[model samples]
Target: MVMGYVSGAVVFLVGLLGGVGLGIACRQYWVEKRNRQTREQAASVIAEARKEAETIKKEAILQAKDTLFQMKAEFERESKESRKEFQNLEKRLLQKEENLDKKSEALDKRETTIGKREKLILQQEKEIGDKEKELDAIMDEQRRRLENLSGISSQEAKEMLIRMVENEARHEAALMVKKIETEARETSDKKAKNIIALAIQRYAGDYVAEKTVSVVNLPNEEMKGRIIGREGRNIRAIEASTGIDLIIDDTPEAVILSGYNPIRREVARVSLERLISDGRIHPARIEEIVEKVNLEVENSIREAGEQAAFDVGVHGIHPEIIKLLGKLKYRTSYAQNVLQHSREVAFLCGIMAAELGLNEKHAKRAGLLHDIGKAIDHEMEGPHAIIGADLAKRYGESHVIVHSIAAHHEDVPAEDILAILVQAADALSGARPGARKELLETYVRRLEDLERIASSFSGINKAYAIQAGRELRIIVESDMVSDSEVVLLSRDIAKKIESELSYPGQIKVTVIRETRAVEYAR
Candidate 1:
């Protein structure tokens, strides 16, 4: 048993040693496998890292190259701009130099021309001064020579020559005047009479006297009350608004308006007609119609004046003067319309001026304005001529024209031909027969009857009107009456007419004494 135990222990010990060697071998193999795996992993990670670093370095180098290229392009463009600006500045400087050269050349030419002109003027002035001194010496020599040759001194000779010339001039002027007077009588008088008679005979116009009162034709007796209105409120409104007095009396279908102002009467006439037509004759309506018609009548008056001026060939007259002239349309002088008389005067003046070789325009203007003073003569206190002259001066007429107007009535001295022409034309127009009518026909009849009374004497034959029927020209028998007896008959006829006549102004008692003894030579 002891032997067997030792052998088995030996066997066990060998087995144990072999097993330990195998275990050690297995452990070494496992460790070697793990170390190999770690080495391979580390190699793979190092390869990946080196590849990423190479790509990053390549990107950085490409970015740097692009940046350098862009910087070079910017520098090239900036250099080109700087070169262009420098070239422009060089061109401008060259042009300025060229302009300066041109200005310098112009200045030199102007200075040269000025110097030449100045020298030429100086030479001319010197020559003129020397000539003037020579002329003065010549004039002095001539004066000395003339004084020695003449008998008297220079001043005494001059006076004698002037006196002799004056005497000769006066003698020649007197002879010319005598010749002109003789020639004028032979040619002028027959021509003047023919022209005046022809003009008067050609133009025959009707004369209507426009009174200050206008009559309104009413519809019926009741219509008059309608115009008067309730309690005469209509009439009162018309008079107060129109400044016209309404005369509503017992006369049926006829109302008379009595007013000194014709334009006011005309206004009331129109307003009453309008009210009668409209059938609304209350105070308010009456006031409205009166105002409207008043304006219309005023316009009518202005138009009439304008027409009168146009018809008479007058121009540049004041509107106020025209209005006053229109007012004269209603005024009567010797029962004839004053405005018509003025128009006739203007026409007559124009005709006379044409025959007399005077200015027709100026003559007509004076005649038209001559009685322009008569338009306001009623309001004024004086002879119409002087008042008219004052009005003309106030209205900016020429002094000569005003003088002509004033001197027409001999109120002022007429020193000019124009004044005398106006006076003569005025007299010819006013003094014509049938040119104006008297206030009453009885007055005209009384003058006619007086002339007839003179003709009733035995020696008178062929009684006729002379000087606007003012003076009677009675043809007497030259066989029966002597020159002294004819003068006595004219005085006796004048004394008889003066007792029978009622005249406003003085009438001339003209006794034309003429004795023509009839004898025939066979």
Candidate 2:
């Protein structure tokens, strides 16, 4: 059993070994087959990969060639467009060159045309110069021939003719001058009289007789004692306060206020009257009254001046000048109120200026201020006109106004129409009847002056001053005075009166030529 077991075991072992061998072989074979299959698969994959790479390479090459062809085509198209642009630019440049050549030719033609015009103008100028020279030569020749024919030179002949014509003109002018003078005198005299009459008629003014002293009428005799006070203290206080003298004299219930300054005198007068009325005349009361009166009088003076200016239609007077004008309210000239006189003069000046077509306001201003110097003439050394002019100059009055003031009184020569107008207005105001008070001697002398002036003429035989020296009636011999001579004689006498005599208003000279031929028929 052991041996058989051994043989079976051996066979089994051998068979197991063979099986193991076969299994090993089979495993090797399967492994080799799987390896071969894997290698084949790897080779196939490699071959396929190669085929795909070749295909891709071919496509890539095709694509690259197509891209190159497209690039070339695009380059060619761009080059074509660039070449076409260059061609167009070259054509434009050629056309610009052709246009430049045309403009250059046009410029050359315009230059030639301008050159021709300049030459023509220069030739014309030369021809005109030559003609002027030829004409001058001909004129010189003609002048010499004419001079030779006339025996005198042309210049001498012209002078001789001028003298002959002048002589004839002189004779005619002398006759014309006489006629013109006659007409002018007749017309001017009538016009002047008319203006003066108009001024007088238009102005309605009341004449106030000026007094040398301001008199304050008292209520009763007992009031005078109250003004004198104890030991004259009140009177002294009043005077000291007002700068005016209080003249308490035997004037019968009247106190005289006296001072060179009209303003001060006015203050003293009003103060005394108030003191007498109040029945309080102590030194303190007197000073208080005088102080009050001073302001009141000053205001009155200012108002009077302003009112006077307003009435005359004058404006823009200096405040100081207006104050001085107000002081004229208390002043007197030739027994006439200076303020009234100034107003009259202003009105007259305005009227005359309006008639003559002059500046009425300017004339009135000059007339109003003409006598302003008289306000302070009592304190001044020179003429009122000079004093007034100095005041106006100091106060910045216009040159014309200052000159007019200075010349109004003939203190200076009346240079302008304003000065002359002022003078005329002043005379008209003072010379009018009842305008100013005149002494008997002055009146008589004025009458004599009129007669003397009228008789001073050549043709007049007898001269008489009628109408209070306003009219001079002259009797001339019929043989000596023709109708024309009579008119001339009257004008001469009137002119002499104006130039020589200083009368207020104009004097009328009337010349009468009477012829009486009486035959005794008995």
Candidate 3:
């Protein structure tokens, strides 16, 4: 029974061992199948990923090509615009260069013409000097012959010797004067070269707009009708009161005032402005306003003159001259106010005179009064320079001042340093930037030309350019020009004007010869 039980246990142990080995084999097979399946799935996923990556790469390349094309088109468009702009700038530059070249050529020609004129002038001066020397030799010969004449007493001989010594002294004096003049001229020339720059640097002043015409501003368009007034009575009254022509036209909110006299025009402007402001539209009111404005203007003129003199450190001017100087406040040449120009000229003269060791006060005085005649030049006939000189002489200004005034414009030769100094100062003042208006100057020159042409004929005492250069009236000397000759003179003047002047419209020429006998009661 023990053998049978041991065999059964070994059998049981073998059976259990077989079962365990079979299960182990089965588990190993299952694990291998799962690993194979996972490998296959991973391979399929890698293939699909590679296909998607290739599609993305192709799309990116196509997008990059499209972007490059757009960039190229944009660059080409910008380059074309840049080229067009450069071409336009090049054309403008070329045109400007051509204009500059033309201007340069014109300047060179003018310079050559001036050089030729200078050479001719120098030649004429030398000839005149030689003639003067010959005259001097002839006079010396005649004097020697007079000295050797026969019938002579001791006293007479002594007198002749005295005369000889006097003549010798005069000659030496002339030589000394010439030497001094030469030195002075050299010094003055050197001073002049630097003086303009220095004076401009040291002095500066404001300028005024040239008021050739006056216009009154109105509060509204309705004021225009009021200015014209009932049946134009107010307009006529204002014109009669102010001696100015008033035009009420299509211009809105403004009334045009026309007159040649700056003072009269200023008065008219002020009066009209006052009337407009006060809302008084009547003939009686117009006259009252005008008269009041006139007196105020006069007082203002006097005050301006006094103020100018005080500012320039000049004194003792005649009262009448002061009034005339004050009148300069309303005077304008080009765009430069006459009073302002005078002040600037005075300041410049003082500075230059100080630099040259001259009387600064005298120079300033002369410069201040240099253009004084312009204040009333419209009322007088003659060059403003000559008129100013006459007025200066009449008003007890020194002979130096009078001469300087006359010579400043070369109406007479500048015979002294003071006169020359005034000329330089006047030129400097006038030449300052923004001092003049070319158009106004041109108009003035035309009027001047009209008078100058009439005066060029002999025996004409005075010439007046009236009606804005449309008419020229000439006053001939009674003794020099007859009635028939006056007609001929007028014809001659008309023909000369036509030939010499470039003008529009017809210019009427009238010549009058009148005799005046003056008697002053003692």
Give per-residue CA lDDT, model 2, range 372-412, as digits (tens): 98777766577678999999888878999999999986778
Q: Which stretches of candidate 2 lie over 4 Å from their true place?
A: 1-212, 379-381, 439-470, 473-522
Model 2 lDDT at residue 493:
77
2 against 3, candidate with superior lDDT: 3
Q: Once superposed on the true structure, which residue ranges of model 3 sit more than 4 Å away at CA?
A: 1-210, 437-522
Backbone clashes under 3 angstroms, per model: 1, 0, 0
Please give the RMSD to the true structure for each candidate, in Å.
Answer: 27.5, 26.1, 23.1
Q: The CA-based lDDT of model 1 is what?
A: 0.75
For model 3 the TM-score comes to 0.44
Candidate 3 yields a Cα-based lDDT of: 0.85
Runs of candidate 1 with Cα error greater than 4 angstroms are 1-212, 376-387, 407-417, 420-431, 439-522
What are the lDDT scores of the predictions, listed in order? 0.75, 0.82, 0.85
Q: For candidate 1, lDDT tens digit of each residue in 1-522? A: 999999999999999999999999999999999999899999899888888889989998999988898989988899889899999989998998899899889889988988998899899899999999999999999888988897567899889999999998898698658656765785577558745643332222221124456788888899887777788887888788877777778877898876655566677888888888889888888888887886777777788788888999999988887886777776565455667777877787788889889789887887777767766765666767898888888887778778888998788888887788778767666555566554245546756776787777887766775564566777777777667887788877876665565443445555454655789999
Q: TM-scores across all candidates?
A: 0.47, 0.48, 0.44
Q: Is candidate 1 or candidate 2 better by lDDT?
A: 2
TM-score of 1: 0.47
